[model samples]
Target: MTKKRHAEIAGAGFAGLAAAAALGQRGWSVRVHEMNSELRAFGAGIFIWDNGLRVLNAIGAYLDVRNGAFAAPAYETRTDGKCLSFQAINGPGQYRLLTMTRQHLHAAMVKAALAAGAELVTSSEAVGATPEGELLLADGSRLPADIVLGCDGVRSRVRDSLAIPQERNKYKDGIIRVLTDRTGLKGGEWDHVIDFWAHSPRTLRILYTPSGENDLYMAMMAPVADTEASSIPINPAPWIECFPQLAPALTRLGDRGRYDVYETTKLPYWSVGRVAIVGDSAHAMPPTLAQGAGCAITNALGLAVALEETDTVEAALELWEKRERPLTDHTQRRAAEIAASRVLASGMKWDDEGLRAARHIPTGAAMPFVDAA
Candidate 1:
């Protein structure tokens, strides 16, 4: 009998967990290492587009995600308190989009990965990795496997250890995200994801996303130079003056809100020998397209499929990068372009050229054995 291939993955974020589930389902021995004492997800809410939904379904996590997610009927944009554009998101020929708290998505992924027989080790920090298929941990030990994956966010120690040439760029704009209850909130299109922009008297933006039935996720965006608008324990005065419609929600912002400056990390290649980088570690891009998690999950599943088709680990890594990188690069470039513009033109549609990846079918989604159970 052939020995089971083993994979050691760093990080328990969307990329790492998705990889775990995909490989484990294919009968590979998988272990995921996370630095935290417990697995948890940061941020308030997340958008899962059609591509991401397809991946979740393939991994058997879609049912759980759908149970707790909100499917928005439309996406709307407003500028200076006037409607700029409104596009139906759930219409015929449109792809599926769901909004949910980051925690909900993470939990569903965790369940799916564990059910696939992947082991999760928390509080075990992977500091780096070797091209020889060894994972270096913080406690002065190395774990060897058939493959090593670096899904460890933008500052991936694994990618750095391999000396991969890369460029990291930080944009001037950032967002402060917070989640508040939807109870008693009145007089607004609560079912749509709304983007409110204020270009004058200091640029400010709000991305209103409804998550599930009780929660509302609001992302307040501004240039990092505008200290008042970007600060935590948010000052509601200016925001209220600009978007009085969200005054009730803005006033409910708590101390847990954190401002994150948008950043993008680009890499020429994703792997070296038996070690490979996935997700943000390989391609972190601006949130303008909201494809960060979508791309991460999609590529993770694609990596598993590539490995299954090839006998040599190096060949699989090369094939995975060749197949997945182009679309991801295009998405990143388009996201950067939109972020640079910082303005959504009137009548802008979500299904434009910028969303090519959303319409893509991942490598293993169509396989009969993917979700066979």
Candidate 2:
């Protein structure tokens, strides 16, 4: 038998919204509190993989996602538009990556959750917590619920209340992004591939795709001091010097304000007591695998499922921690590997001969797979 519940979720990002939707559909009275006056979209695009799409489908919002965004059907590797490694995921069961504006995805999730009977409160932030529930807003107003889930992100206050779990390390890196009007590039040329330019001490990674409405999205990554703010530009000329391959498309972004840049930040411990964390709050990874949002959505779904099967809130948190920690921890470590590869002093490269041999060393790979219920 399904039990009725009242759940309070902190943060309105992808993970929190997904949690709200999943819980509301299962008969929980849910409220999502956001510190932002309105849902804010980061200035970039995210590639939603199949695993995340499956969870969205489970919550009955896949159609909204599919219809509201563009799709990336293939992948290509290039150094300044010159082909290097080409990979296409067209086989049956392979995921058709959905590329869309972060705001659109957030809006879709928020709309789905509200329509599913969730109460969304804007400009609300969680400031404190008790063993029983969360304390929201700076005024010390209490929001008591059967469960409190912290999806508040890397600098989460909910995590602070629990035990102040420290971040494994600082992100100490930055990324630049641009959403172009239209580059007239599509089909086999554009496909669903991300072209990367490896310039030592200044690596460049770009995700190029059309988001259905003729807007082409591109994101570039570079190493930066931890003190650097997101407001800095990644200087396209230095990028060109390192990756002579993207000059064609990079030049087309001229005078357009689409080439914006931002910094990355993260935290380590994602949970404490009845308050548990999901997504970037618990484990923020770089965009190497394009799995940041995917991981968040999956982690949120896992929390919702654990809550559904548990009899008490504490039990639910325990289950969520046990199920999610290992996966997110692994994801974070792998992301570190990817991040190291992008740096020159790190002496790490994806195409390194030793790394290539290690990948083929017959070691077992353990990726978290969502159960098909």
Candidate 3:
């Protein structure tokens, strides 16, 4: 008979689904609760790097992820149309960077989880969780499990329920994304790469990749000093005005005039006792590094391995933290540095100290400039 481990996961985004798939494959019975009645219909794309692909392959979904995505060999960093860094993603056994819509990828993960014996329930937002292992649903229902995992987004109800508010470091100014029917971008290998444009006091990053129907996915970010986290208009006229050269590209975006942007924070710890958090619930960094999703994969894989190694849920949780925290901490720091640098790049605000910091930086060191908080 197969071993039976019952797990309750709150939130069914990429992280939740990935955790469910990993545990279910290990003879665990998994149930995922999500707030939406159906998976999200629209969202921008995520670029999965080699480390992420390696984890996906562990759960047998890397092939599917690669098939549904377009490949890019490298990412470029530019300022005032001048290339400052060109980092290649070439290495032994390195899978090409894959880009695709979050919705499509979420659906793919959900399908994989179900195939691995995970039950996913939509429209079931988790209102609270306890260290003793109980999940409170929005509808006033309760679930008892051996472990509770939170994969909710940045504004996670589960994280709040656990009374583990995230620790704030840097706040998000804004992020905008639009799907368009445009293509044919130029300069420095545009087959499937992400371009990050840095201006002093402002940072603009864009990811462009074909979505397999002659459509392209675009996600951009800019600094917002006046707007609240959720106050950005669906069509942000001001943010677009910052990147005129990319205006034609934005014009080809979706019918919406603005893209969605929001703030982010990082929790000091991703877990307590039998309850743990992953993804945005644990660490929500800027897209500057494009590793937000990649971080989730790392957390999920770490949790999976920890659980597999120990019979006690609490032990697994502790092991999970021990293994994942350093990596996450490194990721968060990198993100902050990159975001700070990008903000400087957009406007050429380099003090003597800034110029000193910029000089002699290694090319690979410039790739993500992202760290997990």
TM-score of each: 0.96, 0.81, 0.81
Per-residue lDDT of model 1, residues 233-326, tens digit only: 7888888888888887887776768888988899988998899899999999988888999999999999999999998999999999999998
For candidate 2, the clash count comes to 9
Q: For candidate 3, write residues 123-226 as lDDT tens digits.
A: 89898898888888988888988889888888888788778766666644556666665455543465545464645334455544555444567666655653
True-structure lDDT of candidate 2: 0.65
Best by TM-score: 1
Worst 10 residues of 2 by lDDT: 356-365
Candidate 2 residue spans exceeding 4 A from truth = 1-3, 80-82, 200-202, 225-234, 240-270, 343-373
Off by over 4 Å in 1: 186-188, 345-347, 367-373
Q: How far does residue 223 in candidate 1 sit from its true spot (Å)?
A: 0.5
Stronger candidate by TM-score (1 vs 3): 1
- Clash totals in order: 0, 9, 25
Candidate 1 backbone collisions, by pair: none
Estimate every model's Cα lDDT from 0 to 1.
Answer: 0.88, 0.65, 0.67
Q: Which candidate wins on lDDT? A: 1
